[model samples]
Target: MRVTLKLATSLDGRIATGSGESKWITGEAARVEGHRLRAGHDAVMVGVETVLADDPELTVRLPRSDEIRQPLRVVLDSRLRTPATARLANPGTMILTAAEPRPVGTAEVERVEAPDGRPAPAPALEALARRGCASVLIEGGGQVAASFLGAGLVDRLEWFRAPILLGGDGRPCVAALALAKLADAPKFRRVSAEPVGDDLWERYDAIR
Candidate 1:
């Protein structure tokens, strides 16, 4: 299976301002494209921080429809810190915990389930791939996204560049890497770039 990384950020590469206030950072076109992409995925994954901060449902919906495409939601709560009230605790979801989790309701629980004792995402991802999840979409804050990028597990990328410049202190939308590490950089060939209000929707492929 393939894992695709998706995110929207300010042109200055900030996911959120220093105050942690951000919404609608991308234009309508970017959101629409995101929904369309979601329609094709079997599941979506996010970190515990994202679940607490955003509480996203990760459903695919269009303007004219009341129904939504529900995918198996996976949470990367390495220490099982996710609260009971989080949206991901609802049915049709899987709670992947590295350790025993708190009693967070009766929703089905799936352990990290890796061949090795390691709880790193790559093995969990491979398990998902074996389950016929052709692609996994990762919608998250910087840390989770950075983990995949650093490991070279990302097969594709979709980034929306907002017009605003939050400047330096804003949390960087992407994680950091050493300059020498870039020698193994993933090749991204731009597939599309169109203006979305003051923002720009960009799509890339990991051709290398």
Candidate 2:
């Protein structure tokens, strides 16, 4: 399966304010474009932290189209921290965790053991493929995006940059990487860069 990391950040590379307020990082046009992008993927994924912060529905909230395709919502909560009342606990949602499968609202809880602290993207991507997911859109809050990127699992990156700046005190767009050398960093080749309303949409091909 192909994994695409999508992110919206300020000019200073911050996804949110210092106080965790991330309601609108980009413009309305960018948000609608994001929803349209989600509609093309087989599944949409995020981390437990994102869930706790946003409680996003994870649904493709766009205008009705002739070919409507709603992607499955996938959550990575290795410890099963995702609450039953979470907004993503709908019928089309799937939770991956190390704990035993427990009943959550219409969603399926699958046991995904990660011996290490980080959940292995290989197995998770394999599982997604087994369920007929050819493509996955990862909309995250730093850690999750870093996990996939660090694991060399991301195939593409869609970054939306707004003109506003959040300064150094804001939350970064991505988490820290444990790279020993500068050459060890994940690299990407820019595929396209276009202006999306007041925001800039950049697409990159992940260099494996």
Candidate 3:
């Protein structure tokens, strides 16, 4: 599957404030652009922490049109921490957990073995592929994005950087990775860059 990691961060690459406040990192145009990207994907995935913190309605909400398609919402909740009251528990949501399967309200549940006690992305991708999902857009908090990038699973990137700055105490766009040297980092080739309101929309292809 073609996986794209979409992120909106401050000028310093901080996605949220020190206390996790990230409601308006980017402007309305940037949000519309993000929804457009979501419409182009077959599925959208996020970690459970995001569901708990952001309570995002993952459905694509664009201008009323016959061509718009809402991608499947998938959550990687290893321990099945996604509560039944979670917004993503609504109908058509898919949850991949490492624990025993259980009915998650209207959401579909799938069990995937965790590699090294963490949710493994390969199994989730395989499952999505079997379900005929050719593309996936990963909208995450931090750790989830890092996991995909660390595993070399991300094929593309859509980054929206606002003009504001968030210092070191703020949350980063990507969480920590176990890189021993600079050469171990994931590289990407810049494909395009454009202005979206006061924010900058940047696109890149993973240099695998």
Candidate 4:
């Protein structure tokens, strides 16, 4: 499956403030573009941390209502940290967990678990494929995005950089890397950037 890491951040490369607070970091243009990008993907993925912090419904909202398409919501919570009341638990909910499957009603879902010792989240992606998802859009809070990059699972990155400077200790916009080695991933580069109000939408291609 094609995996795309999508996120919006301040110019200083902060996803949020020290208190883990972030709202309207990017302008509406980037937001709309993200929604449109979501419509073309099969599902949008994020970590349990994001669900806990933002409680986002993760639905695609196009500028024009007629352009909307509801994508499946996938959460990477190895320990099953998602709250029972989370909106993510309602629709095409997928939890990447390290726990036993639960009995549920009204949710078409699958669990993506990394074994005690193993490689590949492919099995999880395969499960999604069985459910008809051809691609994955990874929305992030930081760690989740880095994990995918570290695991070499991300194929693309769509980022929106806003003009504000949020210099806080919350986390770097990209937190997975230690920065000791610059060529770690060795296969990602910015390919495009466009003005979207005060923010810029940038696209990067990840080499395999």
TM-score of each predicted structure versus truth: 0.87, 0.96, 0.97, 0.88
Residue pairs in collision within model 3: none
lDDT (CA) per prediction? 0.76, 0.88, 0.91, 0.77
> Highest TM-score among the candidates is held by which one?
3
Best by lDDT: 3
Give per-residue lDDT, candidate 4, residue 208: 67
Candidate 3 residue-wise lDDT, 73-151, digit = tens = 9999988889898889978688998888898778999998797655798988998998889999999969899999999
lDDT at position 53, candidate 1: 78
Worst 10 residues of 4 by lDDT: 111-120
For model 2 the TM-score comes to 0.96
- Stretches > 4 Å off in candidate 1: 64-68, 113-118
Report, for all candidates in order, the number of backbone clashes. Answer: 0, 0, 0, 0
Ranking by TM-score: 3, 2, 4, 1
RMSD of 2: 1.3
- Residue 108 of model 4 has an lDDT of 47
Better of 1 and 3 by lDDT: 3
Tens-digit per-residue lDDT, 10-70, candidate 1: 8898888788877777778778878877877898888878888788777777775366666
